[model samples]
Target: MRCPYCGSQDSQVKDSRPAEDGGAIRRRRVCPDCGGRFTTFERVQLRELTVTKKSGKRVPFDRDKLARSVETALRKRPVEAERVERLINGIVRRLEQSGEAEIPSEEIGSMVMEALKGLDDVAYVRFASVYRDFREARDFETVIGELSRPARSAPDDGA
Candidate 1:
């Protein structure tokens, strides 16, 4: 790995172990030239993904960008960090397993919305406002109403 500090091209791994519940490998490395130490986490990619934006532009999938968007929604919320990590992992797994090399950006957003809806209500609304492009107070009210409503019960089959 290249050294982040001195931009050296060489580094030595000092330690390695499982992280993120064995979803990734964490390596502690030291830069030989600058004597700088840093940690890196490696994850296995099932396949390279391309996100097809609404504008018909395709961009390489970015895991960090996904994480950042999730974190932004969960910001200042009471949800635990571990849960957030799992949520992101689950979303990525689903995307990778979809059997498509390219995925629509809307699909990704919907996945995030579904996951957040189950994780935290406030975070769900926060993400929805941006993802759905809420333009008026009525938009917020509509979403909030959906949240407040109880789940529909199964229709009673007469005994």
Candidate 2:
């Protein structure tokens, strides 16, 4: 690694250790020329994800924006912010696991709808109405129909 202080290419690692979470490595390096010491961190580089819109426009993935949409949908609801974050994380993870760098915007919306469905009915409908671009009253009914489905199974281990 090049020395950040002296810009010297000749450097050696003084020490290396794993970070607390074990997701990254921290390295202390010293420049041979200037004896300058510095620290560096190394972490996995996530692959860039792209979203293809209906208008044929491709955009970089934005997780904060997606989380904000979920927050809006869950407004005044009993769901917690951490739950929303977890929902966003789960969606991103699922997309990445698909091994596709580019995903359609509609697919993302559908994923959001499915996630919100498991979260809360009202929030799911709110997000669906906006994401599905509900044109009229019948659009509302369609989502409401999906929301009002009967619960088929017992709750998971979590309360």
Candidate 3:
């Protein structure tokens, strides 16, 4: 790795460890030329994912874009950055586990909605408003009503 302090091509790794979330490798390096130290992080890219939009356009799946959407909904909310990161990771992992090279944009929106719903109800409604393209206040009311309902359990069946 090139040293940022002196632009030296020669560097030695002083220490290496897994990052906080275990999603990346953190390396502490020293530049021989400048006698400077720096840190680097490495992450693995399993595969490229494509997102199929409603207009029939296919684009590479962008984690930043997904984060921005979620963050926008979470703006002014009490959700923490770590929680958001975890939520994004969970969503991406689910998409990857589906074993599909291409995924519909609607599916991505639904996944975000589900994640937000569990994290924060206000954020969930905010995301649903934009994602579902709410045309009137009634749309919000409908979703709120649905969320307020108690989950129904299946009837017991004797074996």
Model 3: per-residue Cα lDDT at residue 63: 83
Candidate 3 lDDT tens digits, 23-140: 8799999998999999997866577899999999999999889999999999999988989989998898899888998999999999998899889999999999999999999999
- As a TM-score, model 3 comes out at 0.74
lDDT of each: 0.95, 0.84, 0.90
Which candidate order results from sorting by TM-score in descending order? Answer: 1, 3, 2
Once fitted onto the true fold, the runs of candidate 1 whose alpha carbons sit more than 4 angstroms away are 150-159
Q: Candidate 2: what lDDT?
A: 0.84
**Candidate 1 residue-wise lDDT, 52-159, digit = tens:** 999999999999999999999999999999999999999999999999999999999999988998899999999999999999999999988877765455654665
lDDT of 2 by residue, 1-159 (tens): 888898988899989998625646999999999988999877553678899999999999887788888899999999987677678777877887788999999999989988889999999989988988889999999878766665445654656
Clashing pairs in 2: none
Q: Which candidate number maximizes TM-score?
A: 1
Better of 2 and 3 by lDDT: 3
* TM-score for each of the candidates: 0.89, 0.66, 0.74
